[model samples]
Target: MGKHALLSASASKRWLSCPPSARLEEQFRDEAGGSPYAEEGTAAHALAEHKLKKALKRRSKRPVSDYHCDEMEECTDGYVAFAMEQVELAKQECKDPVVLIEQRLDYSAYVPEGFGTGDLLIVADHVLTVIDLKYGKGVAVDAERNPQMMLYGLGALELFDALYDIDIVRMAIYQPRLESVSTWEITVPELMEWVEMELKPKAVLAIKGEGEFHSGDWCRFCKAKNTCRARAEEYLKLAQMEFKAPPLLSDEEIVEVLKVADELAKWSADVYAYAQDEAVTKGKKWAGFKLVEGRSNRKYTDEEEVAQAAQKAGYTDIYKKTLIGITEMERLLGKKKFAEILGKLVYKPQGKVTLVPESDKRQEIAASTAEADFKEE
Candidate 1:
C-alpha cells in the first residue's frame, strides 16, 4: 500500500456513493507535486501534532521544520486548544481519559485494505470521541452522517475495544478557518449496523471493480473527474434538452433547466482547466485548442525605488491607510475573542434572494413575502 490506501477513509464518501470510483482512479497516476492548499493543510496538521505532543509531554521525532508559518502556528494552536477542551470534558465524565494524537487507525474489516491516521481520539468509559481538524476553508464539513468520520470512529473502536467499553461514539469536525465545530453522536450498535449494511457491500463491489459509475458532488476531487465518461454522459444528457425560449417554459420546467445549466457550466470549466494543464505541462494537445499567454500586467523591478521616484514627482496620494478587512481582523484577534469584542458592533445584512433546489440546506423564503411580491401588481 502507498501512503494513502486505495480505499482511504478520506475518500470513503466518494467510494461509498460511487463504488467504481476507487477502482477507476487506480488506472491513472496522480499528478506530480501537491496543490498549494493541500500542502498548507499538511503543514497545519504537522504543527497541530507537534503542539499536541508537546502538551502531553510525548516525544515526537518529526519536527515542524519546513511547515513553520505564522498562520499555521495560529491555526494549529486553535486546533490543539479545541481538542484539549474535548479531552477535558471527557475527563470530567469518566475517572480517567485516554488521549491519543496522530494515531494510526485501521478499518480493513469494513473497507478493503483501508487505514488512515486519526488526528485525535479520546476514550473514556462508555464514550469514544474522535476529533478531526480540517484546516481548509473551501467548504464547511459537518459530522452528521459523514462517512469519513464514521470510518475513523470504527477504526478507533477496533483499536481500543479490548481495553475500553465504548457505547457512544462522538465524531467532531473542527474547521478553524471557517470557525465551525460540528459534532454528531451515535450509539456504537447503530454505527456497526451501518458498517454491516452499507459499508461492507459497497467495499465488496468496489474492491472487485464490479460496481456502476455514478457521479455527484463526490466527483469534485476525483483525479479522473474531468474526463470520466459517466460525468461526460451526465452533461450530455443536459445538452440533449430542446433549446426552447425561456418565456415559453413553465416555472417548474425553467427551474429544472436552470439546474442542468449550472451543472453544464461547471463541467465546461473543469474540462477547460484539465485541457489547459495537459497541454501546458504534459505536452498533450487537443485537436483545435492551443496554449497561449492569456494576459499580463507590467510590474516595477524595484518597488521601493519606483515608489520613491513617484513621491519625488509629486505623487503623495499613492498610499493610504485602510482598515483591515473583517476576516483579517478576526484572524489576528482569534475568532472567539473577536466575537466577544465586536459581536454587538457587527451587523450582517440579509443576503439577496436566490433560487435553489429543494435539497439545498438554506431555508426557503417565507410564503407571505412571496405572496406579497406576486400580489397581482
Candidate 2:
C-alpha cells in the first residue's frame, strides 16, 4: 500500500502492544514531529551514505581528510559526524569499497509482507551488505536476526538478484553511539516466514486502523496513557494503595492484595463508564476524564514573574531557567547521561481529578466538617 498504510518493523511491534486505533495515532504522529531517536538514526544513515558515496567516487584518488568536527549540533548532527568519520576510516583501509547508494533505494517489496527503507546499501566482491544504524540509548542493536535488517537484506537481494552473482545477503547494525556492531545472514526461507507471519497481519491491522493491547515496560511511553484499561487499572490501584491508612501489609501480603486490586479495577472501569454515561446524558456534563493534552509545564513565566519579583527584591540577573529537552542532553552528554533525566519524564496521568471513584465524599465529609466547627475554640 502507501506509507500511511504500511507498517515498519518497529511500528509493527508497537501495534501488537496496543489496539489499532492507538497504534495508528502513534504511527501518524511519527511523520508529523519525527521522534528524536528516529531523527538521529536517520541523520546517521544519511551521513554514512553521503561519505560512502564520496569515497566511491574517489576510489582512485587520495583520501578526503577534512572532516566536519563541529561539536554535534544536534542528535542527527552527532550521528552524521561520527558515522562520516567511520566511512572515512573505512575508505582508507579498503582497497575496493563499493558504492554508497544514497536515500534513493526504496526496498519495500524485499521485506516480504512488510515494507521498510534500507539505511545504507553497499556492493563489494558481488556480495551485498545492508547496514542499519541505531542511535538510541536503551539497548545495543543486534543485526543478525534484527527484523528490520533482515527485511532490508531481503530488499537488497531482490533489487540486485539479476545484476550480480549474489553470494549472500549480509546484514549489520552499525550502532555508532554504542560503539558496537551486530550482524546476521539472511536465508531466503527465513525472510519469507517473517513476511508471512509478522509482516502481513501487522500491515493489514495498521492499514485498517486496529491494534492489539499487549503490556510491558513500553506501556509507560504509550501516548494513550489514560485510555489503556490495563494501565489505568494498575495506576488506580497504586494510587489507592498510597492513600491506604493503617494495618499495612508485608511484602508477600502486598502481592496477594494486588490480586484483589485487579478485581477492584474491573469494578472501577464499569463504575466509571456508568458515571460517564450519566454525566453526558442525565447531568449534561462533559463525560470523559480530563487528560493531559500537552502540558507546557515549568515555564520561565514563573521564572520571569519571580525574576521580576526578584528585581524588586534587589537582584539583577536571575538567569532564565536552563530548560533542556531530553534529546538535547543526549546529544551533549551522550545517551547514557541523557537517559537518567528521561526516566523521570514518563507519562503518569492525574488519575484522581475528573475521576468518579466508588465513594462520594461530600455527604460523608459534611457531618465531620460540622462537628469540627462546633468543637473548635
**lDDT per residue as tens, model 1, 43-125:** 78887898898877888755555656656677788888888889889989887799988889999988889899899999999
Clashing pairs in 2: 17-214, 18-212, 19-211, 19-212, 20-210, 20-211, 144-183, 144-184
Candidate 2, after superposition: displacement of residue 208 in Å?
3.0
Model 2, 1-377: lDDT tens per residue? 23532445554345544546444355433336666665555555455555455544543322232222222224434444544554454456444545455333434563224556666666544456776666666767566566566656666766666776656667766655566666677655666777788765665665566656555444534455335666556555555555444366666656656555544555466557656655665874554554234556765556658878989989986665877865465556655555676756645542222222244332334556656655663
Q: Candidate 1: list runs displaced more than 4 Å.
A: 57-62, 65-70, 298-324, 329-347, 367-377
- Candidate models: Cα lDDT each: 0.86, 0.54
Question: Which lDDT value does model 2 have at 295?
Answer: 59
Off by over 4 Å in 2: 1-5, 16-23, 26-46, 58-98, 104-115, 124-126, 165-167, 217-226, 230-377
Q: On a 0 to 100 scale, what is the lDDT of residue 132 in model 2?
A: 66
The RMSD (Cα, Å) of candidate 1 is 3.6
